[model samples]
Structures are given as C-alpha cells and as structure tokens.
Target: MPRFSIVVPVYQVQGYLRACLESVLDQSYGDFELIVVDDCSPDGSPAILDEFAARDERVVPVHLPANGGIGPARNHGVRLARGEYLLFLDSDDSYTPGTLRAIAERIDATGRPDVVLFDYARTHWYGAVKRNRDAEVFGAAGAEVFTVAERPELLDLFTVVWNKAYRLDFFREGGFAFPTGFYEDAVVVYQTLWTARTITLVDRVCVYYRQRRRGNALRTPSREHFEVFAQYERLFRFIEERPELARWRGFLYDHMADHYLFILRQRDRVPPSSRPEFHRRAARDLRAHRPSGHRLGAHIPRTSFTLLSRAPYALYALHRVAAVKRAGLRRRHRVWRRRLRKVLLALHGRLVLRRALDPRLAVYSAFSHRGVLGDPAAIHRKAQEIAPHIRSVWVVGKDHVDALPPGVEHVLPGSRAYRRVTARATYLINNVNWANDLVKREGAVHIHTHQGTPLKSMGADLLKYPGARRGFSVPKMLRRADRWDYSLVANPHSELVWDRAYPCGFVSVRSGSPRNDCLVRPEPGRRESVRQRLGVPDDSTLILYAPTHRDHRQGGYAPTCDLERLVAGLPGDHVLAVRLHPSLARHHERGLGLRDLAERGLVLDVTDEPEVADLLLASDALITDYSSLMFDYAHLDRPVVLHTYDWDTYLAARGTYFDVTERPPGHVTRDEDELARLFASGAWCDEESTRLRSAFRARFGGYDDGRAAERVVRTLMLGEDMAAVPVVPAPGAPSDVLTRS
Candidate 1:
C-alpha cells in the first residue's frame, strides 16, 4: 500500500488542472498515488485527467458516469484510495511545494495521528495569495497533540476538508461519509473533529485554496447554498447522539448563529429573492437549538444579533443604506483629497518657489516616488560624475531614505523641501511625469527621460483604446507633454512615435537612454558579483524571463509561463532569471515566492534587484513580450525570444503600434512548448536569431553610443546643446547597422 493517497475531485477545472497535477507530481515526497475522480464535467477536464494518467502510472483517473457534486466525488475517491492515509485536494487548488514532505515528517514524529490539520493559502485569480491569519489556533494551546475539546477554535480555521489529512482506517471505522450537496465539508469536518481518537496540528501552509473569478459553487448563488441549514442540522444530530460530546453544544450553537448572520449579510451568496425565506429558516433553527448557556454577544454586537433575531427586516434595510452611504463617502473623500492636494501644491509652486528657480538645481524622480532607480538614477549618477557644480536632489519615499546612494541629497515626496525643489529646479528630470498640477516655471527646463521605448500605444493612442488610458485624461497627458523642454529618444522610430502620440513643442533628442550605458560597457567585476549573488554558475547560460504587464488584467498581469515546467524543460546548464513588472512583483512573490524557485535550483528572482542594467549585463539571452526591455537588451546583441502567449487578446486589449511578426527580433514562440523546444533544440541563438537581431538593431539601436548619459547630462544640467556635440557610433554595436531600414 502507498504511504499516502491524494484524492482530487475534478469538475470544470481545465484551465488549472495541469498546474494542480504538476504541483502534486513534483512534490518532494513523491511516494504517493494520485486518485483523480472525474465527475462527468461538461468541459475538457476528463481528457486532461486521462492525459496525466497516461504520462504517469502513479496517477489513476476514475471517470464517474453521472455528474455528482464535489462531496460525492470526494467520497468516491476515498472509497477507491489504497493508501494508509488519504489527503483530499480540490482539482482547482494545489499543494505547495514540499507540503507532503513536511506533513509526512510531522506525522511520523507524532506516531501517526488519526487526523492532521494544516493551514492553507487563499489564492485569488488576480495573483494575490493570502495566508490564514488565525495561526494561533493551529498551535493547539502549545501541545503537538490535542483534542477538539481542548482547542475548539480549530473549527473556525475554515471548515474546509482539503486543508487536512485523514488516516484511511480511522476514517473508515468512524463510519464517515459525505452527504450529497453544498456545505458537505462542514458536516464531515465537525463530526471527525468531535470524534477523532487522536488529533494533530501543523502550522505550515500545505494547501492553496483557490478563489476563481467564476464557476465556483460558493461564488455562484443558488438554492444549493440552502444546504448549509441541513448540514448544520446533521452536525447537531451527530453531537446529540454522542453524550461524551456534550461540552461542544454551546460553541456549536454560537457558530451556527454567526454563520446564519454571515449568510444573511452576504447579498451576493444569498439572493434578494431568497433572503426572507432563508432568514425565517435560520431563525427557526436558532430557536430549535438554543443551547442553555450559548451567547452570541461575545462573537457579534448585541444590538446587531438582537435585531437579526427579533427584527431582521429593519436591520437589512439599515445595512443597505449604510453600505451605499459608505461607498459614496469613500468616493467623495478620494476626489476631494486629490483636488485639495493639487490646489495646495499649485499654490506652493506659484507662491513660494517663484523666485527659487536656481540654475544649479536639478530635481529627479523615477516611476513617481518609487525609488532612486531607473532612467532617473542613471542620469542622476551621470550628472554627479560630469557636472559637479549642478546640485542634484532626489525625490524618494520616506521609508526608502536609508537605501539612497551615498552623497545624494534626498527629500521625501510632498515635504516642503520636495515641493520647493520640484517647483524651482532649473532642470526637472524624471522617467515619468510629476504630479498632475505641477506648474512648470517659464525659464525652468523640464526633461522627459521617458521610462522605456513603447511597443504598445501610448499618449494620444489612448483616444483610440480608452481602456489603456486607465483613468488619466488624454488632454491632461498632452498638456503635460506640452510643458516638456526636451524629451529623450532611443531611436528615430521612438522620436516619430513620441511626437505623434504626445504632440508637443518639446525638442526630441536622438540620444539613446542613459539606462543602457551600463549595458553597453559592462564592468566585469560587477557582472561577476551579480552572478555570484544570484547563485548562478559563471559558465551557465542565463536566460532572463521578463514579460510586460497586460493592461487588460485585473491587478496587472502575472507570469503566464509555467515557471516550474519551464525550468524542468530547459537544459541542465541553463538557468532562468525572472523579473516581474514592478506593479505585480509583490503579488507574484507572495503567490510563488523566490525560496521555492531557488530550492528547485532552476530560477533566480531578479525582480527586486537594484538595476535592470545589472540583470542585462549578467544575462546571455532574454525572453519577453512587448516590454521595452527588449530595446535595451538588444544592445547586447544576445538572443531574445518573444513569448506572445496572449498575442491576440493582448493586442485587442492594449493595441500595439508595430506588428511583432513583421519586424521581429530573435525568434517568437507563442506557447510554452514552442519556447521549451527552442531552448532544448539550441535554436535560440542561431543564425536566424542573429539576422533578426541585426534588423532589429538597424531600426531601434542607432542612437545608443555608450555616451547617452553624458550627452543627457551635458544638454540638461551643464547647459550644453546636444546639436553642438558630434554624433558617434555605438561603441559595441556593429558599424554597418543603420536606421530607416
């Protein structure tokens, strides 16, 4: 018999099934058989399950003839399981890496408890994964082994069966079986907890309970949710049958009252049409099982509970009005706050800094108070190097004061000094625009050292694709561009695009980005140090996977590439470096952290690394999709593979200016398999890649001459005109590469 049998109930989860199966199949403790029960899904889940079983004999796919819900499907899997202990996993959800290994080790240490309760992460479709906050409950009062009577609070750790592992013999002997309907786990979980001979608790994240955008039973409202009433009735009946479990009555009644109130409050789960009937049924149950000493006063407000019990209609109407008023107040507060801040800042700019436009002062910001990094950092450092007389002050977040570079004077954004410098600086340099109301003094120069070369539509193009505008107005952007004294461009193509998209009077300088100067002339020591810090071998082929954010996605975009599978399919000597867009970095980190990738020895997360230049210097190849990094990375003439998995969807959502297929760089792979094949077949850096890179350079790599930083600093800070300076060939690029095809 296998040590553990993982029972997964599958329905319509085709999009996530592969990841779920891969997580299980790749577990560190792999001596387990996977039993996948297919409940006659209407989607392609059955074929997907069969495909997994064909690849790995350890996966057994059982197809049910009829469409049974999750409860029945799980029960079927349990009956077919042939292991000492059985673990239930939902088909849409997954186990974290090393979850089984940790569980098995803990169980062995405790001499095998009847059940082991573990924690779970609530993962959302928008790339947020949150851990359970009630971690103390899993501590079980500081004892490794405890009874439900000792710590009854574990019942509140989400009544989900998937977060726990059950011993097969013990479960069978208890005559445990799930009833057919929704909220079935509540009944089984409570019954097992109350009657288990031995219970153990592990305070580690073992499961990822996914919250899908659609199609979930919980998210979708129907009469089936009414089964919660029946499920609780079953629980109370089980408790009453066992006289030894009498102590749990008070807690159980309190839980029921709270759950009933929660259901009534959740308007989405319980429809308006069903509320009156649901409330009546709930009140009936509360009256029937009103335990002698049970009190809901401690769990919820006394007035609220009393109103819910005595006069629910009044409470319901009051809640509706309060919710609407709260929403309106929140929106009004945000609008008034922004307007007031803008008016005050404009006044400060016009009144206080009117006379402080010092020719020696330059203010720098990147990504809007993000940090002293990006193009702003590059230009700031270059200015300090070449123009010592120019005083440079960086605008940074107050929390990031300690991380500022040595000798650089900094002011927190919105401080008096920051407002004064921003208004009066003779030269204002930034990767993105300053605040919307920033008044540009007539003599003070505003230089737009734009963050990157655009592949997607920007500025005036937002008129065509309003969704891409997010919320900022096109007229506001045009006005902001009009204030620019100068704008930096990487190539003539960018000059044309920027001029058309953001029509303004600013002089467009055909100097490559200062950010790429470090890439053009890399320091050997810095490259070696970065490689060592990243734990990458010196001889390994480092492929950096850096994809762009999708405008269509909620909470921005996440990595579409199956990172674990991507790592597994690559050559052993090659390592993948992942860098997420700044917006989505934190979410992805919390969802699939770097420790797991590092433990696999397949990836190094350079998302938080100080400079993109550093990663560019260390990487031999780049994989991206519509990111401006492509233009910067092309300076190295290394191979680049465009992973355009959502090509059509992305184009439809946020239209691109150029067709990638027409003037492609390196090679393009539309899917994971194609990308993997390119790596495995060693076709990533072939002659075709070189030809495309050469063509890409001829169009986009003309302005970079390893002196863009010096040129920008001279024109803006040192008061030297770029037109007076002689144009030079890029130091490292081939001389024959020319612009305009």
Candidate 2:
C-alpha cells in the first residue's frame, strides 16, 4: 500500500510538464502513489499523464471533464487518492533532484506528523549564469517558522498548501474542500493549517517555480482586492457562523487589516472614476463586517473636515504622495550626482584621482575625440581578454589604474597623454570616444567599436562619424573621425541599423564589439550557483527592481502601489529586491521612505557593488522603470516591469528609440503599487514570454546571450569589420569576444 498520494494537478504546463513528471518519476524514494490530474489542459499535459499511467501501474491519471481551477481540480484528484498522506504539487512547478526522496526520508526519519512542509525555488528569466557573489540577488533564504499559534500577537499564518504534505486523516477531520474561485486555496489553507494537529517545516526547496512568465493567473489585478470589505464580509460571516472558532477574532482582525491595506494600495490601479465607489463599497463592507469594535474606518471617516480628518484612504493617499515628493527632493542630490558625474568623469577622468572602488571604464571611442571616455561592459571585458596578449598598452586618465583589471601596467593621459599611450601600445583600439589615427601615425590597427544602438543620430557624435567616409567639409572634424582605421558590427541587425544611422562613420566592418557583444555566451549554471550563495530558500522568487533615470533630470516620478493587492494576490513565497540605477543611488539614502523598505527586508540596493549582472543573475524577474537595462534583463527572458509614472514628460524629453510598450516587455505600472502587483507575477518560460522576448529583442542587437563579448572580440581581433555597438551594458560583466575572424 502506498504511504503517500502525491497529488500532481495539471493545467497548462506543456513545455515543463515532462520535466515536472520526470522529477516525480525519478524520485529515489518509491512506495508513493503518483496521482497526476489533468485539469483539461489544451496542451500536451494530458498526453504526458497518459504516458505516465501507461508505463507505471503506480501512476493514476485523473482527468476532469472541464477546466476547474487548481482547487476544484485538486479536490477531484484527491477523491481518487488511495494513500495515507496527501502531497499537492502544481503541474507547472517542478520537483528538484531528490526532492520527493528527501520528503520520504524526512517522513521515515521522524514518525510522520499531520503536516510536512518542504521548500521550493525560482528560475531567473535569463538562463542560469554565474554572478558576482556580492550582489545579493539570489541565494539561500531561511525557511518560515510555521508552528501552531505560538505568539499571541502573530497574525494568522500565510497558508501555502502546495508546500505542505498532510496526513489523509487531517483532511478527513476538518472536512477540507476548496472555496471555489480565485484565492480559494488561501481560504482552504487558512482553516487547514489552523486545524492541523502537528506540523513539520524543512528549509530545503523541492519545487522549481517558473517566474516572470508574461501571462500568469495572478498578473490580472482583481476587483476582489479593491472591493476589500465585501470579500472580508463573507469571510467574516463564515467566521461568525462558526461560533466554535469564536476566540480567533484577534487573528481575523489582523487579516482584515491586511485586506484593507492591500486594497488601499491599489487605489491607483482601479479606474479613477470607480475609486470613490470602490472606497465607499470598501467602507461599507468593513463597517458591516466586524470582529467587534476597533472600527478602523470609523476612527478616520465619521468626522472629517480637517487635513488629517479626511477619509483614511484619502489621507494615506495624500501622505504617500507627500512622502514620495519629500523623498524625491531629498534624494535629488544623489540623483543629480549620479547623472552629472558620468559626463564629468568622461571629461576630467584622465586628470582626476580615481576613487578606491571606481566602476567607470576608460574606453577608447572614435566618435568623441577630446577626453578619455567610457561606454559599456564590452570594452572592459574585451580589453581583459587581449590584455595579456599586448604588453605596455597605455592606460590614460587620473584613475585609469583603478579601472584596469589587475594585470596591465598603465600610463596616464594629459594633453600629450594620447601621444604617450599611443607611443607604447601595440593597438589603441577606439572603445569609447577617444580618437586614434593608427592608419596615419604608427601602423596601429584602430578598432572603432562605437557605443550605442544604430538607427538614428540625434547626438553630436553621430553627426561627426556618420560611418563610412562621407568626408566632412570641416577639416578638423574629418581628421578626428578618420582616426578610426577599422569598425565592427554584431550581426546583420547591427549592420542595417548602423547603415542608416552612421552613413559616413564606417571605415570597414568587423564582426566585433568588446563592449556590448559578450551577452550571448551560454551561462554555465550561474543561477543555481548564485542562489546557493545568496542563502535564499530554494523556493523564493528572486525579483530585481531596476528603474532607469528620468530624462527631465528632475522630480522623481511618483508611482502608486497596492500592498494589500500584492499580499492577497501574489504567491506567498516570493521576494522582491529593488535596485534603482546608480544615477539614483542617493535616492534611497536621502529619504527614510525607501531605506525603510529594507527594514521590511524586501528591497536591496546593489549600486554599491561593481557589477549589476550578479544581481541580475540572482533575480528571477526584473522589475524596472523606463531604462535600457530592461534590454539586459530581457536577454534573461525574465519578467520586466515598466514603472513609468511620468511617461508624458519622459517621452517629450527623450523619446524611446523604439516603441517600448507596443508588445510590452512586461506589465507597465504608472504607480508603485501596480508595479508591485506586476512584480508579484514572476518570470515566464512559456509561449507568452517567448513572444514578448522575441519581439523586444528584435529592436536591439541580439547580444543578450552571455557570450556577446566572445563574439565581438573574435570579430575585431582577426581584423574583421564591426558596425556601431549596442547600447553599453553595466560594468564588470562577462568578457566580450569577437570570435572566428
């Protein structure tokens, strides 16, 4: 007789269903009945279950006539289960190696209790890749303590059913059945966990949740969260009807607070016209349904004429706006410093003292000839690859040595710095805007790897080096641009974009860019490595919040949020880490607002680190504002969030090179709460993400594969031609190679 009936409910996980079933089938611990239920999935899920049943007598495939959500579907499967214990597994989420085996061992090791909970993990949008250890993007996190109502003040437990396995008797005792539609599982788990006789919790992750998928169920913002009171009224009515559980009012009140806060947050997401009604309905629901008198709405709503006397929702809304504005003003300096410093560093870099931890790169460019400049990660990585090959390569700038990666000996640049470096180097490649006349002066083959996308030339650099020699009417400008002897391009995509953008800049084309091309390489198990390193529980959804700088250069765009919406809507196990651009590095520090997010222990600021990819790799999804980094995150195929509050101003100032929101990389939120709601919906590896990523990647050069640097270097080193480079990625990224010259 089977000891456990592992209930595997299937919906639409065709791409991953095979892997999910295989993990269960491959479990080292046998003796468990495999109850695979197909909830009328249109995909290949039914076929996989049929195959499983045909092969193994222990496998029982339960088919539902029509599509019922997980609750009803699982209940149907449960009726057929014959084991002593019930283990629930979502069809889309997979079991890791030795997961079921581990659970079986735990049961055997300790006499099985009424409840057994194991952990799960998330996969990033990008294929797993190695990451800088310090970024704190993904790693092992501690397992939540889920013991029987220990602390009096502690609220009702967040009931995640799939994580736990229960004795069949436990279900029979409480007579558990799912509540029906959306969030029904939550209702079942709440009563079930509270009723459990004994429970066991383990930190190891067994399930691998696919994250940031474009169209997941939870992505839709529900009216349920907005109509907070009505839902709670029903829940409370049920609670009151069960006078047997009368003592749990305190716990239920806390739950109600959570509901109110959740709806409060989404006040911005719902239609503005509907908000007054949404609020009025919410107020009525809260007023009608109560555990007794702490009437939350009454305290703030009944008598309100003063500034603070307004409705609590309105008061908090205004407070949030004020707080956001105050924070923007406070962090304005750091934001200003972050933005303004880049230009200054490009100009005065050769003459200033380098800070101890300078992330700036001293790249050589063909377009801007005056000062030493930096562009993208490609130049840094390529230089590293070829650094050993070339001896005495001159490094010119005030802090040039700080930027150099451990090996090369350096020379600083002055007005004559170019002459000094040019004299000593084997090749003075134009990685940034620093000019070089290798074809004219010293027989140096100057590789022109221009920084930025091809297509349009709105900048002075584009006007100067319009790619192939159109020969400028102005002698000085022509001489400076002609300093580039050879140019590089990523592929036919970059080839075409640059053709129109740089009509005269191209001397010759090579298949390289040390700066932007390294993203294409295969990432060798970096996700797991970083996940293990970060100490994140294998099951937590690692989210990265990456917002770009505003073009107007002032006024931090304030976005709206719905905390209750996320808490109520998102899978309870996920975690969000917000990493704003370095340009806004000071924003967090300037106000107690964002810093307090750390107090809640959700957001992480990674700008202090040298590289952003480490954080990217660690994250399962990327939540961002309007920034080019979205493209970098896109390569990972992770979920991307565009939290653009000031889209009007941003478009007016710096129009996106392409229509960014057409296919929409991920959900676009005008408010922080909605953005959070979208972030709560993890990464995707299915059809939806496939379509979004394919369309988005088309606009930029296809260099997201971690190996972009390798391709670019191989192209340039063998004297191949390169067109204009893709927009520079973050610093300290993988090495870019221009291969197979």
Q: Give the Å error, residue 400, model 2.
A: 28
lDDT measured at residue 137 in model 2 versus the true structure, 0 to 100: 15
lDDT (Cα, 0-100) at 129 in candidate 1: 71
**Residues 14-116, model 1: lDDT tens digits:** 9999999999999978889999999999899999999999999999999999998888998898898899898998888998877887778778977899999
Residue 682 C-alpha lDDT in model 1: 91
lDDT score for residue 448 of model 1: 87
Give the top-scoring candidate (lDDT): 1
lDDT of 2 by residue, 1-741 (tens): 687888887887887778777878887667788888888889888998898899888889888889877778888867887788888877766666556655665666557777776555455456331112221211224323334554222123334577678888778676777655556655666666566656555445566656645646544555534533443554565667777666665566556655544544453345555555655665555455455655443333232212222365576557657866877987997889878976664545433322221112232422233222323345545556654343334444553346545654445554445444453343455655343332234444555566534422223333443332133333454455555555565444454454444345445343433333323442577667766765567888776666655434433333324333443455767766666555454441212224334433445545544446667777877666566566555666666666667766655555544556565676666765665555445433345656776666664444433444544444444334433343333333224423221
How many backbone clashes can be found in candidate 1? 0
TM-score of each: 0.68, 0.42
Q: How close to the true structure is residue 241 of candidate 1, measured as C-alpha lDDT?
A: 92
- Top candidate, metric TM-score: 1
